[model samples]
Target: MEQGEFALSDREFNRVKARVYKEAGIALSEAKRTLVVSRLGKLIRTLRLNSFDDYLDHLERQGTPADAQDFINALTTNLTRFWREDHHFTHLETYVGQLMQRRPRGENGRPKLRIWSAGCSTGQEPYTIALHLLAAFPELKRWDFRILATDIDTNVVAKAASGTYPETELSGLSPQQMALFERAGGGQVRIPAAARELIAFKPLNLMNNPWPMRGPFDAVFCRNVAIYFDKPTQGELFARLGALIVPDGFLYIGHSENLGAGGGNFKLVGKTIYQARAQQKARDAA
Candidate 1:
């Protein structure tokens, strides 16, 4: 095939769509045909495959785990930046402040806080959470605070774990915020050790049932992730997230996304911010 001449037949496109949806829960519509071809074309060339059918056959017949991972990485979208949704961070600060004030110290004589940044692409969301919280509340330094940043794409998870980025990625950060990063030579900057220390990056697939973490997290940032799934998948995901969050704990989603009917377990408290209500309802029923 000539350069820039990748062609995906209708059958091939549908096959690709089905595989992606089944494996990743990403609903790729007919409109995404171009995207499928464009993203996968590079990968095909890299692997020296002649056509989509050949690649698909190889994937099903003899592909290794790494090959499957590369396919997912190629199709997965990881567009994100530091403080992309600034208001969510502001709400986070307020919520944490109130939580710190109300919650008593643990038996260990220190308070514990956990925030899960689900679908945290390339680290920004969780790092932003760590930086903002650490700066806004110095007391958190002495407390047991952790941010769990997980994404479906292993490649992005690795990048996020590095906690380093090109300097251009710092465009929106304030001077004070910028100060929290160290100059990584070659036009890159790294998240300061303070913020980096608070986060744990892991590769996770939301479609997988029975997520590993046993959480009653203080908050969850699952922003911009559910939009990729179909309605039923989205509903199931939000419901599962509700189960893991403590009553009154906050959930922040992407501005473009909404919980719709799936949000029955949560109450809308701010722009795309929800407070979990299931535990409270159970207590009331009791």
Candidate 2:
């Protein structure tokens, strides 16, 4: 078949869908068939494969870790921008302020302020969080602070690590916010080293077992990630999230995502935001 003429049959599409679901916990509905075709088509063409079956076979035969990562990267949709949801940031700033006021200083030994941006795409979200924190509390520069920005897509993780974005990407941000951070030329901007220093980017598959870091994170920003997961998968992921968060720690999900029927130990506190229940946290600790 020619470059643009490659066809994806139902069998091949379903096979790919199953593989994606099994590996990434992303349930691709029938409506997403076109998306799969369009996105994977580029990969198939680049590999000069005639059909989706050929591409699947290549994936099966190679079975290299990198190949699997590539498969996920090709199909994953990463749509995000700096300060995409302003209210969330406002809430975050207030939360950080409260925490900062309480965090022990000097001889008292201040606890490290930690936040996790799960499914962080292209690094914008985490970078934005860093900037927000810096602007909210300049004194945070003296405290031990860290932001873990992770995504399943290795490519996006690399981009996030680079901390570079085009000027147009700053559309969601205001001039005042822009001015606070360092900027690079060529119609592109790089996150200031000060903000960048607070973040560490890593490639993470949410469905994978034995997560590397055991976190009692102060907050977890998992916006727009669980929508792709089935209800059961979403429940399990949130349960793990509950376990990883500190007592009363906040969990900020996408506007569309919710705790659902099996909300477990999370108490809905705001629009798409939940706080891990103190009672449940105590039980878990016991």
List, residue by residue over 86-113, the lDDT tens digit for candidate 2.
7888888988889877776645475588
lDDT of 1 by residue, 37-138 (tens): 888888888889998998999899999998888888888888898888899999999999998898878888888899999999899999999999998998
lDDT of 2: 0.87
| TM values, all candidates | 0.95, 0.95
Question: In model 2, what lDDT does residue 151 have?
Answer: 98
Q: What is the lDDT of residue 86 in candidate 1?
A: 94
Task: Show the colliding residue pairs in model 2.
Answer: none
Error of 2 at 190 (Å): 1.7
